[model samples]
Target: MSKVTGDAFNFSLLKRVMAYVKPYRATFVWSVLLTLLLAAIAPVRPMLVGFTLDQHILKGNYTGLVNITILMLVLLVFQTAFQYAHTLLTNKLGQSAIKDLRINVFNHITKLRLKFFDKTPIGQLITRTVSDLETIADIFSEGLIAMIGDLLQVIVITSIMFYMDWKLTLAVLVPMPLLIIATRIFQKAIKVAFQEVRVEVANLNTFLQEHISGIAIIQYFAREEQEYKKFEKINVRYRDANIRSNWYYSIFFPVVELISAMSLGLLIWYGSKTILNNPTIEPGIITTFIMFINMLFRPIRELADKFNTLQMGMVGAERVFKVLDTQEQTEDIGTLAPQKLTGNISFKHVWFSYDQDQEAAPKYVLKDISFEVASGQTVALVGATGAGKSSTINILNRFYEIQKGSIAIDGVAIKDYQLAYLRKNIATVLQDVFLFSDTIFNNITLNNPEISFDEVVDAAKKVGAHGFIERLPGGYHYNVMERGATLSAGQAQLISFIRALVYKPAILVLDEATSSVDTETELIIQNAIDKLMEDRTSIVIAHRLSTIQKADLIIVLDKGEIKEKGTHQQLLKLDGYYKRLYDLQFSSVGIAK
Candidate 1:
């Protein structure tokens, strides 16, 4: 198993990985010294027995035998103590290394821009952080330590055997070449099996997470049977991979055992012939030779087990490294603040496409257009479905970068400002409201933990959520379930509005924040928005033209460009896209202006 082939056993990877252990070098050294001590004592028992058989038992000297027995017992006690200490220190070192790695991985992941999450699946990321890290811990605690011990034991035992009787050692080693060849073959199979098992496990995890999260969707669509079939397919693949691994592992042991048994038989057959032919060969010497035979083969069996674990760990390492190596969407290491100017945003000669492959003659989700939202004013973006309205808002957040032209926040290029600093200043109320499974008060005061309960009550009242929250069983302490699933859509939207308003950010972006509520609730929120946008930069994306009629400016988007732009009254007079949208809406409402 030590002969693992191909890229899995890359020496460069191991050398690169050694740097992670530098912090715990002192602990590592102690572990190595303990391992060497343990291996050195492997042949002591046989030596003690030989001493007893020669100088005491054979000559009927019970006193010498008794003294030697007591010494051997003391040595055993010391060996056990050292073994326990070795495990404790190694475990401490391994856990510390894992903690450091987890911290680095999480910090890097959170620093990544929003676009990274859009492209990567949540399940894959979770697997790297949890399962993959556990595998690495296993490598350190079990595989790595065992491999070190086995190597030392093999070398030390071979040296002692050669010193005791070189001819006997050579005879015992006759079957070793065949054993090594078999191990080499088994190692390749083991690596392939373990790699497959790791991948299948990842797939199973991904499938489970996705299905569980979307179970309601499946039930709503009455596709439960279809989802079950899909899940079964993934589960079957996982089972097949496990079975394949078991097949490889089952063959591994028997082949190794057969070779070991054959080698021992040969050793016994050869050593006994020598003893029979030469009366000068002491019974004690023969007994020691047989004991050494047992010691020599133990390390070989352990080496195979350690190598199998190392191969499994390498498979997990490959998956984990994939995450650590991912390039973040936006990485502005420069510490630059936004420049001063009017809060006017413009898309100059702006052309954008979400897909890069179709860049040439790309389906412009947003076309070459120019528009501006003035400082301290509400700008409403109105468009039909698939008219690039959401994409436009996404670009404003820099969730996706524009391929052509540029987006400026407060008349300064978005790229110039640090992403963390930019996001900190912009507050958003998304169409799909998301709430953590926490108290309503906690969700409202997400960033401002120091915010007084009075402040939370004020924000909630502003958004008209305080009335319902106060009526709940536990008022502010009512525990929301995952995503606040128990709350009605309108209630969730109200909570989201309160969350965004409590932050009191410089820039506010609300996408259909009032869509879920009735006309009465909408009017209440409209009053709240009127107060909230008094001196703040606000952009509202709404389908109901009535909800945004009071905007300082309104831009109508078609495909990916601005088709019309003006104040609500001015756009109604254009008799263009905005007029058509307004007429269609009012016509549905059976109202005429």
Candidate 2:
């Protein structure tokens, strides 16, 4: 949602982008050398034609004219060869640089803290990595390298014109100051236009991505017409931004052509007047000066267009660098590298909130919360919606940092353990399980080559998912489409359980893991849960109290505070919030016997 605003020619951003080009420096150097050679060769044909006209053909020397023509043909071949080499080398250089840059952006994004993703739209990040990177490739393939060649061509042509005749050259350059002013104005306008175009493009992609992912919900609610209208508005904005950019181009090219024609006319007018007075200026010199003027202005015209390419590329580079420069990365300062944890967790005097800022009023999700789970015990968290049950689990996994608290595992602060090592010891299964669009076997192993096929089958069999998976077309190799759409909700949940079990973590966290399963599946999952929880710390957030009745301890939460703590039977005798919740559930659906 952030707008990109910067100068059209940003040297700092250019230097940063060029750093990516440095790795393929050898190829880039070859491309630049080819560009210069092409520029040097470009003027030879016109110069040769002028020489042939003044010295050979006009004097009726047939052999001399034939030799000049053959030389011109040879120069053409060399020019063609140089152009081909330049194109091939620059393209290879551009692609290699973009490949490295794209990887760097993706790597940086992975290192960013969860909070960064919480606020940033996934579509914006996609645009930064994909489309914006393509624009940067244009800088090498179509913009920067070509612009350099154009610059050299312009300089060479201008020098050749002065050598031929200074007076005519001065006359041809008379319109230059006006052309420069016009170009500057065009650059400023197009820069703003391109920025608007990029902003609208990002907005459109964000809107489309969100709507497509939630299309099922939209159709279920019968809001198709409403969603379509919203999309139309976004599409119109994107179209209008592009039209504005085209409007600038529509005016720019003709103005350049008019200036070029006027300069050519001035050159002819001055040559005619000088010829009458001196009688020494040859027609071929006039012819060659005209060709030189065209060569010079042609680059000028093309440079305007290439400069726009350069500006757009700079805009993309600026956006990409912003993401790369972000400081919202997870801190990995801990040195502790334990092979396995003892699964003892303690949250002492924890005061926490999602937002931790000095100026904002504190909105704590957990306050004065203190609890401990022994090395091998099942602790269940039961609470009403928005009662901090899920937040407690999130903190234990260290998904978000806690503001005022010390969360320790095996007597060491959670922050004192290496982040990756800490996470590897904890496995979680959420109510809404997500599976990648991969074979069931790969999904279970998460593409980890270390996890053998036998290990996966054993994990699934233990979780009671193996029977259903074997009935499928490909058994373990069945490809579950995006989000595992081919699998039922209960089946998906079972696969998630299998995934967690295969990891053999020191701690397991389940958030409403069985809330979607039927009675039969729930029983099967419960049996698996019992086996999975043995000799490991387990945390459960359960809506179905029956599923957690045998937990070693049950902690009842109300409005971010613990209101009751006991065994299920002990809590019932206490007749507190837990008992009330239990009775209400039993009265509505009867207790599962």
- Highest TM-score: give the candidate number: 2
| Pairs of residues clashing in candidate 2 | none
Q: Mind giving the per-residue lDDT tens digits that candidate 1 earns over 378-492? A: 8888888888878877777777777788888766787777876777567899889998998888877874766778888899988778999999879988877889887888888
TM of each candidate vs. truth: 0.93, 0.97
**Candidate 1 global CA lDDT score:** 0.78
Model 2 Cα displacement at 513 (Å)? 0.6
Runs of candidate 2 exceeding 4 Å displacement: 1-8
lDDT of 1 at 565: 88
Worst 10 residues of 1 by lDDT: 1-10
TM-score of 2: 0.97
At residue 127, candidate 1 shows an lDDT of 79
Worst 10 residues of 2 by lDDT: 1-10
For 279-318, candidate 2 gives per-residue lDDT tens digits of 8767888888778878888899889888888889988888
